[model samples]
Target: MKDTDESIELSKRMIQTGELCGKTTTAFITRMDHPIGNAVGNWLEVLECINVMKSGKGPKDLVNLCLVQAAQMLIQCGAVPSGTLKEGIIMARENLSNGKAYGKFREMVVSQGGDLRCIDKPEDYPRAQFKADVIATSKGFISDINALEIGHIGVMIGAGRNCSEDAIDATAGIWFHRKVGDRVEASDAIATVYTEREETLNSAADSVFQAFSFSEVPVEPEPLITNFVTKDGVSNFSMSIFED
Candidate 1:
């Protein structure tokens, strides 16, 4: 809801049309609080998703975000009870941990003619020819990571395509080493940039570093979930719950 006009309008239109979402079919609405995980680019996202599926432990915030979204999706679809969110989370975790999630991913890959070798051994997937770590300059908490600028860095590195005609390098991306509310030192690795080409590495490094902000004061990160908009009304999450 914070990002797209079309999404807001689509929800409104659905309600106006006949309350099809909440009444006929359940609709779960949520927005990404950050880049959505530890990975901030194309191939990086794929690898991150796979790691989460295989291990059930990658980034805590990402794992929970996915589990919460899945739980809510099940509840709204009536497959799970409204009171069973916690249980639903457990179920989702089981699916992720027990190879159920990877099975679906593999099926999709085969359907699309993607290399089975990569799916079987994703660690052997294409890696950046060059890599660099972005280290923090001070001892403090990560106050912010600019989501948009980080995305632009991916585009600059060719992980993201500028237009439909622009070819994207599936191997290029950045991996977050620290996130908001996390502590860091004078030289803690906050992120890693990956790309095959050296031409864009330096500038991309600058953008990646500039994208983060640090502070000595403690920081309370924004909620991954802001609210739930349903047929009845919006149920807002209290921001006070996170305040220090």
Candidate 2:
């Protein structure tokens, strides 16, 4: 289920009524507007995240956001204690800082019969061979990084599939060096686009470049976890009634 305030309340009520009790459920709540990093392809995204957990050279905001969201959900579901949530964040930060997360991810990749060597050097990974650099237009803090716009550009560049049978170019993606609240000059490089075809690369780069906007002031950071909800038996509050 999408991790919105309404959805979370609904899920809690269903569980309280013993309807969805004992049933395994998964919920995802991502920043619908701004996502982290630049890569969106299946294998490439894995590699990027792995690089993050290994080298600490990637976008910090994106990686940290994902870790915190995952930890919060785990704690809310009782899979892990609430106290451990902070620990999980700490551990994730440490693993990324120390390369432990990278090692663990590499192990998982190998266990799944995938080659770990490919991730050792991302430059060696297959590429579209075409590249374009996104240049900033003004001097200000990065206010937004639209995920949907980035995903759209990824699809256009062949990093994502438009149809079920369509193939995705694992190397055709983006690499972001700037994020929200980061100051940039008018000509600073914000991101780089990679694609197998020159034409696709050009079109994707144009689209992606237009996705970014700047302001004279810094943008306020959005809240990661909005609120928590639970069923109230005494007041007769339930998510089911809200649905009707």
Q: Give the 10-residue window scoring lowest on summed lDDT in candidate 2.
A: 233-242
Error of 1 at 4 (Å): 9.0
lDDT of 1 by residue, 96-180 (tens): 8898988888899999988878867878776889998898888998888888888788888888878999988889999998888
TM, every model: 0.83, 0.75
**What is the per-residue lDDT of model 2 for residues 113-161, given as tens digits with 9 covering 90 to 100?**
9876787776676666788988888789888787778888888888887
Off-target runs (Cα >4 Å) in candidate 2 are: 1-28, 56-58, 69-83, 95-98, 227-244
Highest TM-score against the true fold, candidate: 1
TM-score of 1: 0.83
CA lDDT of 159 in candidate 1?
86
Query: What is the lDDT for 224 in model 2?
Result: 40
Candidate 1 overall Cα lDDT vs. reference?
Answer: 0.76
